[model samples]
Target: MARQVQFDQLGGPEVLTVREVEIAPPASGEVLIRVEAIGVNRAEVMFREGSYFLQPAFPSTLGYEAAGTVEALGEGVTHLAAGDPVGVVPAFSMNDYGTYGDHVVVPASAVVPRPPGITAVTAAAVWMAYITAYGALIDEGGLKPGDHVLVTAAAGGVGLAAIQTARRIGAVAVATTRSPDKKQALLDAGAAHVVVTDEEDLPTRVREITSGEGVRLAFDPIAGPGVDTLAEAIAAGGKLLVYGALDPRPTPLPNAALYPDLSTSMFTMFRVTAAPERLRRAVAFVNAGLSDGSLAPVVDRTFDLDDVAEAHRYMESNAQTGKIVMTVSHAPDAS
Candidate 1:
């Protein structure tokens, strides 16, 4: 039996429980992986709370990112063999496959070889954050060198990834966070400027930073009344991409009356992964960034597989500056 995380009810972190369950071999177009590390994302919290885009069935497993060595390959899977180190992308739906287990089965299309010199923990953290950022800022926003981009919630994994991805493209990344304490850390993480939202007005600070102009794109996860502030901070003809709903409050629509030139839309990483050519471009772009040291996965903390609930609590606390990774330990399969 393989140890996997599951929750029968929709609720908080306490609802999650680890259990030993039989894992079947991969079927056609699938690959079985012995998970070494799992990346914790805010989506899982929303999923467990029954607030995500996809709802879960009872006793469902939840996960998106994982890194490990391939243990078995299903029929027609010709590219990978057993013992190859790899990472699983968040391309598949959580309801269809999960990686929060010592051993997990995932679609072959979701598997990518881990680049040399990156540890499993780091590998586990890369895809979701970087790909999400790339899809929004690069693919969708059309970010260019010397252009300014606003990155809100600058301490989370995706926030940090957006900063790095912007810098990698020669654009300026302006990071925003409510905590003044994280300012220096965000600056050190490649953000050209840091905006403390609690102390400073977002639009004023962004305007000052841009010398009376505004950022070409504002990448935000928190969608509520605060979106009006972001709309004001965006330049005319720019875009405001909202990729997540960290705030459950109702969002206000302020574009038509205030900033008609500004365009706003919701984004997800699946938009890039769903298209084959786009996925190929995203993977190649991210791999090149990783190989060249332009995009580095910053792991803020780690927890044992059994401490998943605590990890979830930590993520919900918003105390982390980057990715929270879960280390998995495997035992010899008796089968």
Candidate 2:
């Protein structure tokens, strides 16, 4: 038996519980992994609260990123073998698969060889944040060098990833956060300028930073009344990629007459994996960034698997500047 996290009902972090579960052999095209670390994301929290795009079934597991070693392989799987280190990508639906467990079975296609020189904790943290940013900024936004890109909520995992991605592409990354304490951290994370939203005007700061021209692109996860603010900060013909709703309020549509040339698009990782070729390109890009040290996983803290609920509580507190991870204690037989 292996320990796994599950929730009987949709609710707060307290709804999650860890229980021992029997491990089953992988079926065709599946790989059984002895999970080493799990990456906690905002998406899981939203799913638990019954506010996410993916609906949760009662007695359901919740997670999308993890790293582990291959303990067993199923029929027709030849790319990996026992003891191979791998990271689980957030390319599948959470309702169909989950990574918050001592062992998990996932499609072989969703597993990528863990990048070298990083711990399992770092590997678990990389895929969801980096891949999501790659899809939104590079694949969807068509970001180019010297362009100014505004990243809202620039202290979370995906926000930091967007900042790094923009810098790697030679674009100016302007980061925003409500807290002044995170200003230096955002700057250290590759943000060209950090805007304290609570103290400064977003659109005005952006306009001044770009020398009266607004940002060429805006990557925002916070949607709501803030949509208008983002719309105002964008340049003519600029694109705004909305990937998440951190605000619980309904997203208000941008004023078309105010900025007719501004295009607003919703982005999700699903768009990156919708095409096999596109998925391949994204993976290659992330791997290259990791190798060159341009892309690094920022881990705020780690908890044992048993303390996952506490990890979730910490995540909800909005005090984290990077990824929160849960480490699984390996069994005696686990490699």
Candidate 3:
């Protein structure tokens, strides 16, 4: 049996519970993994609250990212063997599979071999953030060298990943945070300039940073009433790629009459995963960044499997600057 997190009714962090579940053998095309570290994401929180893109069935398991060792493989699976280190990417639906457990059965296609020199914790942290940023900023937004890009809510895992990705592509990254506490951290993480939304005007700072011309692209996850401010910061003919609905309010588009060249679209990792060739390229790019120390997965804190509820509460508080990971402790085998 393995310990896993599940919620019968969706509401708040209190709804999640850890329980012992039977570890079933993987079926065909599935791989059984002994989870080492689980990466907590905002998506999971949204799903738990019954507001995510995918609705939850009663008693649903919740997770999308983890790093672990292959314990068993199903029929027709030959590429990976038992004991191989791997990372779980956000390539599958949480309704079908969940990584918040001591053991998980996931489609083999969703697993990637862990890059060398990266710890299990770091491997669990990188896939979702890097892939989401890569898909939005580079694959869909067409970010280019010398272009300026604005990243909103730029202190979370995905936001920091966007900053690093922009720097990796030789683009100027203008990051925004609600407070000044994370200003230096964002700068250290490759942001060309930092804007405190609570103190400075977002559009005015962006214009000054870009020397009167607005940013060429804006990557935003906080889509709500604040989106209009982001829209005002975009250059004419620029695009706003929004991938998350962190805000509960409706996202309004720029007035067509005033900014005819402004374009806006939604981005999700699902679109990138739909294309096999594009997914391969994204993986290669992230691997290269990890190898060269250009992309670093910052781990904010770790909790044991038993303290998952507290972990969820902490995540909901939004105090973490980077990834919140849960470490699993396995029982000793009695041979």
Q: Distance from true position, residue 105, model 1, in Å?
A: 0.3
Residue 327's C-alpha lDDT in candidate 1? 99
Residues 200-295, model 1: lDDT tens digits:
998998999999889999999999888988998989899989998888898877658889898888898998888878888888899899999999
Per-residue lDDT, model 1, residue 263, is: 85
Candidates' TM-scores? 0.97, 0.97, 0.97
- Cα lDDT of model 3 by residue, 1-335, tens digit: 88999999988888889998997899999999999999999899889998898999878998999999999999999989999999988888889999999999999988888888888899989988999999899988999999999999999999999999999989999999998999999998899999999999999999999988899999998888777888889999899998888888888876777678898998998887767788888889998999899999888999987887888899999899989999999878899
Any idea what lDDT model 3 has?
A: 0.91
Which pairs of residues collide in candidate 2?
A: none
In model 3, what are the clashing residue pairs, if there are any? none
Top-lDDT candidate index = 1
Query: CA shift at 31, candidate 1, in angstroms?
Result: 0.4
TM-score of 2: 0.97
- Candidates 1 and 3 compared: the better one by lDDT is 1
Runs of candidate 2 with Cα error greater than 4 angstroms are none
Model 3, residue 149: what's the lDDT? 96
